[model samples]
Target: MTVKAEPFDLSGKVAMVTGAAGGLGQCFAKTLSAAGASVVLCSRDRDRPELVRLANDLAGAERLAMDVVSHASVEQAFEVLDEKGIQVDILVNNAGVAISGRAQALSDADWNAVVDTNLRGAWTVSQQLAKRLIEQSRPGSIVNIASILGLQPSKGTAPYAVSKAGLIQMTRALALEWARFNIRVNALSPGYIETDINREFLQSDTAAAHIKRIPTRRVGVAEDLAGPILLLASAAGEHMTGSNLVVDGGHSCASL
Candidate 1:
């Protein structure tokens, strides 16, 4: 007998994941697809081989070339979706960059790149989606991929941590303002997840010492955040908004 996925099922929903070419972004796209949502894998380059391959592996998936930092690019991406008659109800703002450096040493361009992509970019995407949802009187969910560093301090991650902190606050502020429209906004902050973005750092001596501060005594894998991602994306978390779900293996609570 065919069984229904009662709790985390996302059938009949459409999820768009940004930065789908990256490690955690890829994981989010795959996870949403596995839960029955028709996924749209987005990257700066739609024709990227990795993104194209990912789209081919999923059912009813589409590829979008979107640079979240550019308002024109974001607007164009949505326009393309509208042309295709695809209405996305689930959005994963997972496009982010980390430039490792101290605050004093980082260049203005580097700082702007990180902040523009992580904070302003997220705002643009959320606002775009919320406007359409409100127009159609439809409900939707937005999941922002944040980090433990947003809640605390991390060396050599000044820009990334600050950007994530802004995103977390943005999640709450948007949730409060958009709840009346039935739009739920939340953040998922992961701790030291092993991905291409930070695999080398997580495996390095500095990270090794830092890992001991986590109660779990180990770094997390992308799979570790799947449940939290689904909870914020699906009906299972209908009543949840303005919430930041930190999936950091107790790293946030740990003391030096």
Candidate 2:
């Protein structure tokens, strides 16, 4: 008798990525799709033409309107998935917002918005998806997009920093609790990536000066993180759980 060896083929795996209209989330969705996972591209607004177009191009991908901060929206989106017969094998909690200001100057709205979207949103999505995975008795993976600010911090972005720190701890706690069910939870912390949300900052002289401090001496591109994103979403990271994979050009080590 001969034994055939199978490889890291995610042929039947399904992935749900929040914030799919943004650069980082879009990269995750496309990368998972390229690796053979049927992907669910989700955003708060269902009318994003670019996201819809890209999802259509991905052959096995679909789109959903998910407001992670709203339990009703999240429930409706998952119900859509169920109706479509989609079983999510991976969930990427990448929906986030950044509000940068001195803590003393920050308004209630600014603080609430950041905390609601970045921290609570990830928790809601993870809890909902984990429940589904547990019910099905299926193994799953979850990757939450955190930030280096979670480990270190800057003075102005208190809410964003605190939210990310909470996200990292959430990943660890969830991983510990869900390990028995074969559901792995982890965080991907990217440092100084050039994306639409930060385009103006990236082009500013201050951002340029900051990039020079990095050991890599350059800013990170969206595609640079795509490979790591794919690895975690696929069987390549099957044994990895509760880890924070920092893909930041070594900036966390360099001091001002």
Clashes of each: 0, 0
Task: Record all residue pairs in model 2 with backbone atoms less than 3 Å apart, i.e. clashing.
Answer: none
Index of the highest-lDDT prediction: 1
Q: Candidate 1: RMSD over Cα atoms?
A: 2.7
lDDT of 2 by residue, 138-173 (tens): 999999999988988866789999999999999899
Q: What is the total number of backbone clashes in candidate 2?
A: 0
Cα error, candidate 2, residue 217 (Å)? 0.9
Q: Each model's TM-score, in the order given? A: 0.96, 0.95
The per-model lDDT (C-alpha) reads: 0.91, 0.88
lDDT of 1 by residue, 1-256 (tens): 7544586899999999999988888889889999999998999999999899899989999999999999999999999999999999999999998889878999999999999999999999988899999999999999998888888867788989999999999999999999999999999999888877887787788888889999999888888888889999998898899999999889889842
TM-score of 1: 0.96
Segments in model 2 whose C-alpha atoms lie over 4 Å from true places: 1-7
